[model samples]
Target chain A: MRHYTAEQIAELPSKYRAHFINSCTGFKSANLLGSISEDGITNVAIFSSVTHLGSNPPLLGFILRPTTVDRNTYENLKKTGVFTVNHVNQNFIKEAHKTSAKYDGTVSEFDKTLLNEEYLDDFKAPYVQQSRIKLGCTFENEYFIKENDCHFIIGRIQHIYVDREIQAEDGWLNLERAQTVCIDGLDGYALPQILNRFTYAQPDQPVNSIKDLGS
Target chain B: MRHYTAEQIAELPSKYRAHFINSCTGFKSANLLGSISEDGITNVAIFSSVTHLGSNPPLLGFILRPTTVDRNTYENLKKTGVFTVNHVNQNFIKEAHKTSAKYDGTVSEFDKTLLNEEYLDDFKAPYVQQSRIKLGCTFENEYFIKENDCHFIIGRIQHIYVDREIQAEDGWLNLERAQTVCIDGLDGYALPQILNRFTYAQPDQPVNSIKDLGS
Candidate 1:
C-alpha cells in the first residue's frame, strides 16, 4: 500500500483538498439563509457541512467557514434567531450550488437562482419553495472551534415540510424517488439507487436472521 | 398542497419517523459495540447516523437513540471511551443491520456477523477489517438533547483505514467505485451513482459551473 505524509496531503491543490474530496461523498447539500437586513433578506449560502444534531427537539446543525468579508448569514441568524434549511434535489442542485458564491451584501441568491421562495407563517426567513424538503429552524446556539475557522450553528427545528409520497412505512424516506442528489468532491452530484433492505440483528448469533428484525 | 399538524406528524408510526427517513439516505451504516462485562461484549446495535465530523483532527460522530434500555453500545462506549465505527457496504448491509439487535450482555455481535475484526495500533477497539472505510475513534464529547432521546457522540478519529484505490487526487474518496451503501429509513440501502459535475459560481450568473470556479 502506498502512503503519503500529512504534509504531502496538505500540499495538494486547493481543488484536491482532502476536506473537499472526503466531504463530497457523504453530506447532503443544503441552503442556509436568514433575514438580517432592513429588507429582511440579505444572506444566503449553500452548505454541505450539515447533519442531524438530534431528533427530540428536532434539531439540526451546519458548520460555516468563518469569513471576514461579511457575516450576513451568521449575523442575521444571531440577530433574528431564525433561519431556514432547504434541501437540494436533482431539479435544484445546480441552482442550489450557486448559492455558495460570494455575492455582494445586498444581492440575494434567490434572485439569481431559479429557486422560488416561500415564507411560512410566523417565521421571518423564507424557505426554498422548490425544495422537496424544507425546515423552519430557530437559532439554538453557536460554538466556534478554537483552532478551526469554522462555526457550528445549531438550530431547533420548528416546522418541517416533506413531499407526502416520499414517506415510507417505517419513517424511511425514499430519496431515490425524491431524486435527492448527494455531493462528492468539490463539484459532483450523485443519484442514488436502492440496492437492498433487511432487519437489524446481532452479527454473532448462530441463527441470526435479518428477516426476523424489522426490515 | 397537503398539510399535517405537528401532532399528526408525530403520531406517525415508528416506521415513519421524519428525520430517521430523511437522514438515513445516502449515508454509510455502522455497528457501534461496547463491552459491559470484563470477558464479553454487550449492547450490540446498528446505526446509520454516523458522519465524518472533521478531518484536521479526524473527527467522526453518530447519533444514538435515547431510549433507556441499558444500551450496551452506549454503555460500552461510555465506560471504555472507545468504540469502532464499522462501515456497512452492500455485502454487509444485512449483517450490519443485525448488529442493532438488543442482545444479552454476554452476546458478541461481532461473533454473530460475517465481519472480521482488525485492531489498530493506536486504539484498543477492533474495527471491521472488511469495511472499505473504517475508523478507530477515541471518545471526545457527547451531547444529550434534553428534549430528545438522541445522544450525539463525537469522537476524535484516531485512525482511518480506506482501500487505496478509492483514494483519488488529494484524498477524494471514490465511494461510488467502492460500492458503499447509503441508508434510507430503517431497512433501505442506496447505491450511489455519479450524475453531474460543475464549478462553483454565484447564483446570479447566467452560467455557473463548479468546474469553472478555480479556473
Candidate 2:
C-alpha cells in the first residue's frame, strides 16, 4: 500500500478537497429568494451546501457564508426569517450555476435566468416555478463552522412540491429519473445511474434476513 | 403544469422522496464490523446511510437504527462508541450487502461475508480492506428523528484512506474514478457520471464572471 506523508496530503491540490470534487460533478442547486423589500425583492442567491437535516420535522439546512461582504440572501433571510429552496435539474443547471455570481443587491437572478417564479398561499417567499421540487422554509438556527467560513442555516420545511410519477414504495422520490444533478468541486455535475438493490440491515451481520433499520 | 393536491403528494410512494431517490442510485454497499467476543476480532454489518459530513475536521455521519430490535451494529456502537465507515466498491458490493443480514450477537457477520479486514494504528475497529476509501470515526453525536424513528449518528473522522490519483486541483476527490456508490431507499446503488463544468455566479449574470462560492 502506498502512503503519503502528512505534508503530502496537506499539499494535495485544492481539487483533492471533497467539497471541490463534489462541486465539480454538479450539486443539487437551490435558489434562495425571499421577500423583504416592498417594491423590490430583498435578495436572491444560490447555494449547494444544503442537506436534509431531519425528515420528521421535515428540517433542512445549508451553509451560508458569513456577512463580511454584503450578501443579499443573508440579509433578506435575517430580516424576513423565510427563504425558498428551489431544486435545479439538467435543463436549468446553467441558470442555477449562474446564481453563484456576485451581483449588486438590486439585480434579481430570477429575471436574469428567465426562470419562472411562483408563490404559495400567503407565504412571502417566491418559489421557482420551473423547479421540479421547491421547499418553503422558515429559518430555525444557524451554527457556524469556525474552521471554515460557513454557517449552517437550519430551516424547518414548511411546504414542498414534487413532480408526480417519481414516488416510490418507500416514500422516496426518484430524483435521478427527474434528472436532478449532484455536485462535485467548484463547477461539476454528476448524472446518476442505478446499479443494484439489497435489503437494509446492520453492517455486521449475514446476507440473508436483512431487516429494516427504521420502524 | 399539472398540480397534485396535498393528499396526492402525501400518497406519493416512498420512491418519490428525493433523498431516497438520489441515495438509492449513488451509494455502494459496505460492511460495518465490530468485535463482540473476547477474540478481539470483528463482527460485520452493512449500511448505506454513511455520508461525508464535512472535511475541515474530516467528519462523517451515518444513521443507526434504534435498539427496539436486536441489531449487532446498533448494540455494538452503543456499547463501544466506535465503528468504521467502509466504502463498498464494485468488487465487494455483494459481500458488503450480505453484511446487512440479521445475525445474533454471537454470530459474526465477518464470518459470513467474504471481506478482508485491516486495522489502523491499533484502533479497535477494523476497516474494510477491500474498500477504496475507508475511515475510522469516533462517535460524536446522535440525533434521533422522532417522526421517522431513524437515528442520525455523527462521527468525527479519525482516519481517512483514499487512492491518490482521483484527487483534483481544488481539493475535490473524484469518487466515480474511485468506483464509489450511492444508496437510494432500502436496497439500491447507483453509479455516478460526470456531465459538465461551469463557473458559479449569482443569477442573471454571466457564468465566467462569477467567483468561487468558497471564496
Best by lDDT: 1
RMSD of 2: 6.2
lDDT of 1 at B145: 47
**Per-residue C-alpha lDDT of model 1 across residues B1-215, encoded as one tens digit per residue:** 23434455566565455545345323333334433334445344556556655556456566677464336667777778777665557677676676666656676766776666666564566667667766556678876644455666777655556667766544466666666666655566677776666654643565444332111
Write one digit per residue (lDDT tens) for candidate 1, span A12-95: 565565444354225344344545455666565666556665544456666666573236777778777888776677787777
In model 1, what is the error at residue A193, expressed in angstroms?
1.6
**The 10-residue segment with the lowest total lDDT in model 1 chain B:** B206-215
Task: State interface RMSD in Å for all models.
Answer: 3.8, 5.3
For this target, which candidate reaches the highest DockQ against the unseen true structure?
1
For residue A88, model 2's alpha carbon misses the true position, in angstroms, by 2.1
Stretches off by above 4 angstroms in model 1 are A1-17, A24-38, A53-56, A66-70, A142-151, A169-171, A200-215, B11-15, B18-45, B65-70, B78-81, B200-215
List each candidate's DockQ score: 0.36, 0.29
Q: For candidate 2, lDDT tens digit of each residue in A1-215?
A: 33433344445554355453232222233334444444456444555556554444456556565553227777777777888776667677677666666766677767677666677766787777777766677777765545444555667666666666554545555656656666554565566666555555554533443232222
